[model samples]
Target chain A: MTSDVETRVVRIIAEQALLEPSDVKMTDTPVDLGIDSMGLVEAIFAIEEEFDISVPFNANDPQGSAFDISSVRSIVAAVKSLVADQTT
Target chain B: MRRVVITGAGTINPLGASVPATLDAMQEGRCGIGPLEIRDVDRLSVRIAGQVGGYDETAHFDRQQLSLYDRFTQFALLSAAEAVAQSGIAFNGALAERAGVVLGTSGGGLNTQDDNYRAVYEEGKNRVHPFIVPRLMNNAAASHISMTYNLQGPSFTVASACASSNHAMGQAAQMIRTGLADVMLTGGSEAMLCFGGVKAWEGLRVMSKEACRPFCATRTGMVQGEGAGVFVFEERDRALARGAEILAEVAGFAMTSDAGDIVTPSRHGAVRAIAGALRDAGLAPERVGYINAHGTGTTANDRTECAAVRDVFGGHAERLVISSTKSMHGHLIGGTGAVELLACLMALRDGIVAPTIGYREPDPDCALDIVPNVAREARIDVALSNAFAFGGLNAVLALARA
Candidate 1:
């Protein structure tokens, strides 16, 4: 089981967009929030920079059906996995 | 038709803000790419970036001008002010509305938007910043330029991915030729060295691992950079009447689109842009002495750009002193073409072609005179600066000795 940084991440995203955390769905993708490709890039970049982790640049090949990585939960999950791997 | 000439130019590149410092670094063939300074790179796969450090507009800002400006526009406006001030060109009473401004930018206010996102998402806050809209909009910098310089002329921002600055410069030159504006403040600004910004770019998968090695077989991709580049372009007669320092003549400008793919560059677009610029400059291909390539050091840009050069100029491409200042300055994206154009103008003015530093190996496809790893002094009568961007935008500007 991983600690949920997604909870904090969701809260952060909600605060930035002036949306209630209650309105934020953990599975909802960045696209649902009107975060275009450019916006998504910046959001992901900001998180990586903040957490000091090297997230994979291309999470999914352009052609593949990428993981539903649109949510704060998924992003934080990815981050936690990296951190845990380093510690182990 | 009015003849446009560069009266003043200024920049805040990774090598250092001033023209002299950055030029010194360019002459010595230094790379400004390094690890991220503003963000925690512990987790990002891409770690390095070219950054403009500790440039607080508050230190150099006028109190009244601060309200209308976002950080990116603030940077461009401050640089423009410095340029116009140094140009010694007096603004005519009527030039305000007719004297235009065209600024280039790919990412505008991403830094401020990131902060606003942090505020709302992390804090679960309700109220966004009051200035968020103005700060986040792509045209904010151009708006600020108009207001700051009392420019009522046709003012707009050009956002064609990395080609934004060259687009702006081309359009400004067009305005002068069409008699739409007598004088124009043209350049670009970007602050993409921020945390969130880098993350977004990493997804593209074209970024380089070490330094940008344009025209090199060992090249990886481009090193991201952030900064602003500005030039004050005025009609030559107007400049002479005002005793303005004529840096170089903006002889010809041309633009094209690859219309091929969003990401991959089209050699077709590149070659046409080169040919179009040559025709607009009223010169033969062989008459051109040098080329400031849109050498992003990425595999796609360098190769396609070279093919384009060879296609247009033939054997002369081998003799041409082609170089990318991005080797030293990194890719300023939207601001790249503007500063690269400045480098081209400077080359024309001083007769010294700056080098492409990280070019160690010879890329077979990129077979051109890539002023590899060192600067060279030459007789440059006409120099062309090339800008090719994502989404197939291509722009070329020609500068000749006045």
Candidate 2:
């Protein structure tokens, strides 16, 4: 089941990758989508704006960040968790 | 071709207010960064900076001059006065017409802009100060210096973000080398530690709140600083003939654009700039004993600068003593290179290499003798100063002992 958060995350990532939302896959990584470091930052910004949550991602050290950006599914899960934290 | 050399140098930075004082601070490996003392300090997330503390504008300038002089301009004028005094070159008839000023600054009168913006937007004030335009213009410092010194030829300002100082100095050297000018007053100044300035940089998320630790694995990011450094670049023959004290020879200068990312620094661009400077100076890689790195303490900048140094110097890279004074004084943005050049002068003339303070854990990626935490005494014949800006612009300068 694609939650609203998952759908929005996919759309944002797809926008940065310059592809249609349907073309993006849940199992695909940012590298698979040809998203560069700057592209990833843009996608993070878009997700933060859409969800109104501050993403703890530092562009200087993206890999060490707690925000899981390894795969689309992982990003969706991270966003969902952050949204839940905001609510609770 | 005529040779260019630095005859006089002066500076007012967070580390100190004069060349001797600044050199003393650098020799001690002292950290000048502290909690910023500005308006609305509670509102800023990144509250620490290398600000010029205990500065009173009224003490330096009269009421009439203060109306037209911004903080950056005041710094430039004060430093330029010291430099001109040291050079003993009275710009009267011929020298005045032949000499000029070239300064670099990214945010000219940013404080003035921030103040007026607050007055109109935040405080709901309508009328603004009349001299605001003259006070806030980018070329205001250069113009004021030119007017004060009666410099009537080839006066201008350079604005290339972080590489502004190096670019301006390089142009000044070329003017003297090409017989366009006999004397040129060149350096850089930046005073952007205002609320609006900090707020804007906060959006980029590259500032470190705690400390600036370049080449350290525990490093977070860069810290903002504010100050100015001014110098006298003159033709070698003229300076020798006049018996003026020559600090260091402006051996070579080269600038390159990355043409890649807008914000992320490129290793290739930095490498090429270093290599080009060496080629221009006719110095071998091994002869270069010290490098004043454009080490902003950011993870991306430090690693990339280290890689570039390795690529250019190869085995000699390990032998060369490199340090980032920004660790002590903070990054002055456009004016950083000008102040860092003083480190090169100290290395060549005083035989003392500045240290990169706040370095705790070393990063394997930046494996080199970074002169960490303590100043070292090393007699170096030649040194290089590097400046890499946000727009992928890179400038490297080579200086040799007089």
Q: Please report the candidate that would top DockQ against the real structure.
A: 2
Q: Model 2 segments beyond 4 Å from truth?
A: none
Per-candidate iRMSD: 5.6, 1.7
Q: Quote the TM-score that chain A achieves in each candidate.
A: 0.65, 0.96
Q: What would the TM-score be for candidate 2 when compared with the true structure?
A: 0.95
The TM-score values for the models, in the order shown, are 0.82, 0.95
True contacts kept of 1: 0.10
Across B171-267, the per-residue lDDT of candidate 2 in tens digits comes to 9999999989999999999999999999888667678888989999988889999999999999999999999999999999999999999999999
lDDT of 1 by residue, B154-254 (tens): 98888888999999999999898888888999999988776688877777766765677788887777889988888898888988986778999988888
DockQ, all candidates in order: 0.09, 0.48
Error of 1 at B19 (Å): 1.9
**DockQ of model 2, rounded to 2 decimals:** 0.48
TM (chain A), candidate 1: 0.65
Model 1 TM-score, 2 decimals: 0.82
